[model samples]
Target: LWLPGMGAAYATAAPADPVPWRAILASWTASHVAHAVDAAAERLQADGKRAHSSQRLTQARLRQTLQRAESARTVRERRSGERQRLLAAHAAWREETHQP
Candidate 1:
């Protein structure tokens, strides 16, 4: 028999507990999902920084290539002009020799 505020009456337990296990599990899943999203965001930021660095390096390489090509073109032009001058001088010498 139970009495009010007595030892046996105070120890009475619920016939069926209303524990929300499903809600607790959902909360756990949401926490893990948030962590995963944060990790993905960090990885994406790192990849973006790396991509930007690579793009800058590519631009620098392209500029170096263009400068080298221009230098080569200038050298070729100078050499061609010198060759034409030499050919003209040779022709003039041949003409003077044949004129007696």
Candidate 2:
């Protein structure tokens, strides 16, 4: 009689229900989804930074090219003005010397 009661007590002490499989699967799926979303957001942020840097570099190069063009124009104007002055001096000298 004491043995039967001891077996009955042991049986009641432990659970009879098995472990749930669906709960485990659901938890794993949710974790993966969250991880993927975070990775995509990080990638998008990096791409935006790269795009901003590229635009700044392009603008700087454009400004540099414009400055060079302006400098070239000033140099050409000075050279043209000097050439005109030299021509005028030569003409005046020729008038005074009078080659016959």
Candidate 3:
């Protein structure tokens, strides 16, 4: 008998000899089970790889975000310092001009 998907043929015994139906069934079942296990293992491996890649991408994005935030904070601090210096100078100039 020809097994579909296996591409192999199984021959039956001569008319006088009994056919080994149990052996044929067992072999077919084992082949199908093994195929299923292999397929499951491959899927798990692929999923693990995808998860690892996603984790790396997330870490990179987080690092970039932190760097941008740090840069922005530095700029703000510098602007604040400049504003304070300008205000102090303006106050000094006003006091000198108003002195009688």
Candidate 4:
């Protein structure tokens, strides 16, 4: 296999700046931790977006329900008024027909 830092005679590292094992391990650990933090942040952001959407949907449903209730109340009031009018008419007719 053709390795970048190896020579034809022996397989040895030949980087101009020799890095200690501790330094290499520390850098690797830091890189992994940074990646983990970034992943967690992304998940948190997605969760926030989902929560916002859920709140909006819930509010919209509540508004629709409120509107329906109001409309039902209006219809009920109108029907009640009609019944009162009919009762008044019936009373007037009774008085006129059965005159004392």
Q: Tally clashing residue pairs in candidate 4.
A: 0
Candidate 1, poorest ten consecutive residues by summed lDDT = 1-10
Q: Candidate 3: misplaced stretches above 4 Å? A: 5-19
TM-score of each: 0.67, 0.71, 0.77, 0.74
Per-residue error for 40 in candidate 3, Å, reads 0.7
At residue 41, give the lDDT of candidate 1.
Answer: 100
Residue 87 C-alpha lDDT in model 3: 90
Across 19-52, the per-residue lDDT of candidate 1 in tens digits comes to 4444445555566678899999999999999999
lDDT (Cα atoms) of all candidates against the true structure: 0.74, 0.72, 0.78, 0.74
Better of 1 and 3 by TM-score: 3
Give the per-residue lDDT of model 2 (tens digit) for 19-90: 333434444556567889999999999999999999999999999999999999999999999999998888
TM-score for model 3? Answer: 0.77
Superposed on all Cα atoms, model 1 deviates from the true structure by an RMSD in Å of 11.7
With a 3 Å backbone cut-off (N, CA, C), the pairs that clash in candidate 1 are none
Candidate 4 Cα lDDT to native:
0.74
- Best-matching candidate per lDDT: 3
Evaluated with TM-score, which candidate comes out highest?
3
